[model samples]
Target: MSRHLLIETQGPWAGRECASFVRDAAALAGGGHRTQLLLLQEGVLGAVPGVLPELDGYLAADGDLLVDRYSVAQRGLKQEQLVAGSRLVDMDEIAGNVLDAAVKVVWH
Candidate 1:
């Protein structure tokens, strides 16, 4: 059966861990699992344009890339400044919908 994977990232995207998460999310999506990469805290930096190329492949694999709305506002980033496929989602959506619907959730 296909599984829903939700990955919650909470640190700066410039780190090795963030890069690894992108690669892993791509792998999971390519393997036929539905993947969602949710950026929170400093992780919202990953949604910024030109910051990380690793996200391109993940997005190509049909990953649902999202940034926390609160995080974006906190960092003074506009919704339009995020990467092309990334969307701004509220915490309620993350906690009440995404997390509850995912077969597995990982924090990176």
Candidate 2:
């Protein structure tokens, strides 16, 4: 059975678990686990290309990742700034996906 992992990262890496969450999720995806990263607020910073090489690596591998478009825009990140394979998702859809998933990991 495929398990779902929803990683909600908020804080910046130097302050909290954001880095760890991104690294772990990337590792999980590399290991063939079903994982997705949802970026909100400062969390979207992790999705910035070239800024986070670990996340960039996972994205290069086609990781299932989502960044709230509102967040991205609010954070001043353009669509081209997002990591590859990452999609823009609405808050309601994010909530629904979390509710429907087997596991939800929030790194706040």
Candidate 3:
């Protein structure tokens, strides 16, 4: 199966676009693709509950969630504050995903 990596650079305040992105990611996962939603920059804010409930739906759809370790720590977000099923990953891992030929990357 192909892998889809969706990078979210915007926070929840960025509006419907962010939610729509999560929805699209979920759809990809539900369709049997390997989908991953990466939260970077202010997008790390979405790791918290209620910040982006759509994230929960994405997880339910079998999509993986990744929060940039640097972004979360820089924003003072603790591991416990993140949504369940979300993983904190190094920037290098993110770069690897983007550079991988087998993975499709989408940044917004």
Candidate 4:
């Protein structure tokens, strides 16, 4: 069976907690699971260019990377400011769709 992982985090990517969250998401995706990362609150910082290069490999592996549009705007960041592979999504859309479909969800 295919498993879906939804990882939600809210903080700067430099923190230990954020790093672990990214690591765990990548590891799970590497193990062949379908993984999606949702960056909210300060966690949207991870979507900033050069903030989290580790996520590149995961994206290359087909993992989905999303940044909350509200969070980006709250931080005065534009869509273009986000990393190349990251997509901007509404929190409601995530909750109604991705979250509902995910087999497991992790928050950090």
State each model's CA lDDT, in order.
0.79, 0.71, 0.93, 0.77
lDDT of 3: 0.93
lDDT tens digits, residues 1-108, model 2? Answer: 354555555645656467677777777777777777777777788777766666776665556888888888887888798777778888897778777747655545
Clashing pairs in 1: none
lDDT (tens digit, per residue) of candidate 4 on 1-108: 465655556565446777677777887788888788888888888888777777777787778898889888988999998888888998676776554754677667
Candidate 4 least-lDDT 10 residues: 5-14
Ten-residue segment with the worst summed lDDT in candidate 1? 5-14
The residue pairs that clash in candidate 3, if any, are: none
For candidate 3, the TM-score is 0.97
What 10-residue stretch in candidate 2 is worst by lDDT?
1-10
Candidate 2 is scored at a TM of 0.79
- Where does candidate 1 stray beyond 4 Å? 12-14, 98-102
Candidate with best TM-score = 3
- Model 1 C-alpha lDDT per residue in residues 1-108, reported as the tens digit of each score: 455545555555356878888888899988878777888888888888788778899999988898899988998999889999998888787876544754677776
User: What stretches of model 3 exceed 4 Å from their correct place?
Assistant: none
Clashes of each: 0, 0, 0, 1
Q: Comparing 1 and 2 by lDDT, which wins?
A: 1
